[model samples]
Target: MHESPITGNGDVVKARQAVRVLAQEARLSLVDQTKLVTAASELARNTLSYGGGGTMRASIVTRGTSTGVKVVFSDQGPGIPDLDLALTDGWSSGRGMGLGLSGARRLADEFTLDSAPGKGTTVSVLKWAR
Candidate 1:
């Protein structure tokens, strides 16, 4: 796994680039690469703006004959109090339209989220090669 710090908007861009590289290395199609990159951008921005910055871990994952990329974003900031509400479309705790999490989930083949009021949050998403 490779970890990159997400301290600001610039770091979010870096995260997107990093994911793009990994997706390319995994032999993902251009469309799949774009999807993963876009999802990474959104999640990284959320990590910085909402979670007060965090770390993004990218890794290559293989399952049988399938290979994919997995990214996990973690932060120590104030966690989502109501995950259900937070996951709702158009719900925003800050200035965004609240589409980051839901949108990322929609782009990835698999998505998982873990958060607590004071314990912080971690979101993991995966995109498989076609």
Candidate 2:
């Protein structure tokens, strides 16, 4: 298993690179690759745009003797006051199409978000090799 935690503006780019590499190595479908990449990109942007910039971690997970890609994005910003609202389409705290979380959710095979007001936000996603 490999672990990486991204921090700062440039870290997001690195996170994207990591995602691309994992997607390629995992031999995921082109459609799944596109979705995963786009999800990572959007999540990375959210970390920068919302959080004071955050962290992204990637690792190879072997569970039940199966291979998978696991990524986690976290931020220590204002934090999401209403997770339900944040996850809704066309709902945003900024000038976005409100698709960040929603879109990311649509792309990932597994997605989870943990957030609280004044605490911060963390999002995790996983894609499997099929």
Candidate 3:
């Protein structure tokens, strides 16, 4: 796994680029690569803006005969108190359109979210190669 710090805007860009590279290396199609990169970008931005900075881990994953790229974004900031509402479309806790989490989920093959009120948040996304 490769870990990139999401301390600022530059770090978010770095994280997205890293994910793109990993997706490419995984032999994902061009369209899949774009989707993963876009999802990574959204999550990275959320990590910086909402989570108050965090780390993004990118790696290749395999299950059964399938291979894919996985990215995990984790932060130690105020956790989402209403995950259900947060996942709803057109919801925004900040100035954004609030499409980050839900949009990322739509783009990935698998998505998982973990957060607690006083703890933090972790979002994992995986896109299988096709």
TM-score against native, each model:
0.97, 0.88, 0.98
Clashing pairs in 1: none
Q: Rate the local accuracy (lDDT) of all candidates.
A: 0.92, 0.81, 0.93
The sequence of per-residue lDDT tens digits that candidate 1 reaches over residues 47-126 is 98889999999999999999999999999989999998888899888867789999999999999999999899999999
Which portions of model 3 miss their true places by more than 4 Å? none
lDDT, candidate 1, residue 108? 96
Q: Candidate 3's C-alpha lDDT? A: 0.93
Query: Which candidate has the top score in lDDT?
Result: 3
Q: Output the better candidate (2/3) by TM-score.
A: 3
- Residue-level lDDT of model 3, residues 1-130, one tens digit each, is 8998999889977898899899998999999999999999999999988999999999999999889999999999999999999899998888578999999999999999999887999999999998
Q: Compared with the true structure, what per-residue lDDT tens digits does model 2 show for residues 60-110? A: 666786666777888888899999999999998775688999999988889
- Evaluate residue 45 in candidate 2 and report its C-alpha lDDT on the 0 to 100 scale: 83
Candidate 1's displacement at residue 84, Å, is: 1.2
Give candidate 2's root-mean-square deviation (CA, Å). 1.9
Q: Report RMSD for candidate 1.
A: 0.7
Worst 10 residues of 2 by lDDT: 1-10
